[model samples]
Target: MFEKSYDVAVCGGGIAGAAAAIASARQGKKTVFIEKTVMSGGLATTGLIYIYLPLCDGYGTQVLFGIAEELLLASLKYGPGNIPNWRIGKNAEEAKRYRIIFSPASFTLAIDELLVNAGVDIWYDTLICGAQVENGRLTAVEVENKSGRGRINAKCFVDATGDADVAHFAGLDCPTAQNALAFWVLEHAKGAKWRLEGSIESVSMHADGGSIDKKRGMSGIDGAEVTKFILDGRAKYLARLKKEYASGNQSRTTLFPLTLPSMAQFRTTRHIPALYKLRDGEDWKHFDDSIGMTADWRKSGFVWEIPYRSMVPVGLKNLVAAGRCTAAEEDAWEVTRVIPTAALTGEAAGTAAALCADKGISPDELPVTVLQDALRKAGNKIHLEDVGLAPKK
Candidate 1:
């Protein structure tokens, strides 16, 4: 039962949400970053995701910049990873992609430091239960914390919850996709040789874990279903450990899990239906509202321009989305729901949220040119052509 106000309020403290909050606060806006978890970096930290995908096109050049690149380099402070040598030619192997493997705990500390240095008001262990809207604009978001239930009033909001929690609560038709069961855990393996040839040693360190497939794929929507998914994953993990120990392998007996993913590692569960739905085969397509550029980490030479419209849920004023829940069709979800893309979209949405709040305008009505200019000033390449990539006919 309290009330507070900010110029921009970012929900979700994942990579996307952290980036958004940083961008907004750096602009001198009164910004608040709220998270359901106590830590930051979302899937990257809490979910035990050890990879910071890539910021480059496979063609020997960087495609993503700004906060995306900043965070990537920041991850190396306490973890292992390397920046791609711009002179290196196209890389066919994923190991050669301009990516890095980071320690989840290390990343959590780094991101927390980043937000604090940027002067963002961070509220951990806070859950956004609902949003208040009037005349088609989001007014405030209702939240529950140890203190009690209250509202965070803001002129603008960024939904970086990775599940579109804010957008869904706002009554948008967010779509859900089937998620295959995969479990990632951090564990200690004594003297494990973890790096590949020509890889950075620091980035190659990770826990010994495996993926498990269930007969029925996971759809993490209802509380009961999500709980089942967690239990099943843990059950599979335990069974494997038991089998390995019973085999009389001394090494297996020494293995122990340091941490399980704080959140389900479901890559894609839900996304907001945005003004523009990014789909497959639209690679290198340019949009007037392009906010930034991203590359498909799974492949080489494929690039896509992320439209500002995609972050703005249709008919929702003063609200934008970032991370996995940003608007994208199921096919495009594979690209959009990764570490790099989440940071990219988060930077755009956060910057946009600040600008919209300062100008007293709705996000839908914010001029594309103004937004693009601001993004470019931040060192983001908004078009593939800007990165020397040609659009395919």
Candidate 2:
């Protein structure tokens, strides 16, 4: 098998992995970004989840910054969407929240450009199949692509796969969650109700149920389960199209799917049990080791300080989990699973990995203060007070 080396290896090319690779490369570390698909942005772009989510606390303040905000702005460079009143000042109205809906194709192009500009080595259509661990530290990842199997050795690794694939392969205890069946498709129709701004396409959503429950949900970790889940979602989409055409309101020429999600739309999957497992009801809580802040996109006035410890999985050295694979529990997972928080944690993980590599130490050994300082230097606001806010009473 061919072997390569880098300062940092990032698994997954989604938003989180993209942010991680970019952050690591910008820190002057040699970084390699691995992805199973051709495009970046993961669910945000490929899964038809176009909403960038809010970067503000939803009250009147911007809580998230750094690469999170950078990716949000980049998503618009090739798309037709804007955050009204964003530059002027904060808007308290929920409708005016700091968010934008971008075209998936356009955002993919923008992020690809950003990755190249950041000097990140990108391996598209590459899947991570295994991991190499020695003395409690991850040393390399085995990958499969058209070139056959290969191994990538790095000083540090970021598991941004959104499923904790790297951590799981490294023998870490990663908990699994059930995901409700759902499908989103981009379509074009005459008199489309959900048409995107400045585009001829509209997005439609189909779901098996409103809430996720064990009875009606499936795990995304299993190969067969993932296959079934994706098939079920596509079946739902087919039924919807059939029903729409049966209504006789539109013809095939007027209403047809323009694009379907290139990947499964599982909301939650596997996550490592990190040193600090962030749980629900801790919004606005302070953490001395906070890497950055993320707002609850579902509601206003709720924000959480993301701890660096939450990204460090137990029993793993030189490896950190980011994005949806971070250690978040229950309601906390819901908050951190979105696009904004993914980018937030991804940037933090990448920076931490680079720092660890530079020190020739594991992530658990790197001082939190060092990581925090680096983040702040990179334009990230790590604490509530940094954004002129305080812990919730």
Which candidate achieves the best lDDT against the true structure? 2
lDDT against true structure, model 1: 0.83
Cα deviation at 283, candidate 1, in Å, is 0.8
Evaluate all candidate structures by whole-model CA lDDT and list the values in order.
Answer: 0.83, 0.87
Per-prediction TM-score: 0.94, 0.95
Q: After superposition, how far is residue 251 of candidate 2 from its true place, in Å?
A: 2.1
Ten-residue region with minimum lDDT total, candidate 1: 196-205
RMSD of each: 2.5, 2.3
Compared with the true structure, model 1 gives a TM-score of 0.94
Q: 1-393 in candidate 1: lDDT tens per residue?
A: 899999999999999999999999988899999999999999888888887887877778788999999898888787655655544857655657788777778788889999999999999999999999898889999999999999999999999998888988888878887776777776654444554224433323444343457444766877888888788778887886787678765345366675788898777777888888888777778787888888888888888888888888887888989998987875577788899999999999899999999999988889989888888998888887887777773
Measured with C-alpha atoms, the lDDT of residue 115 in candidate 1 is: 95
lDDT of 1 at 297: 84
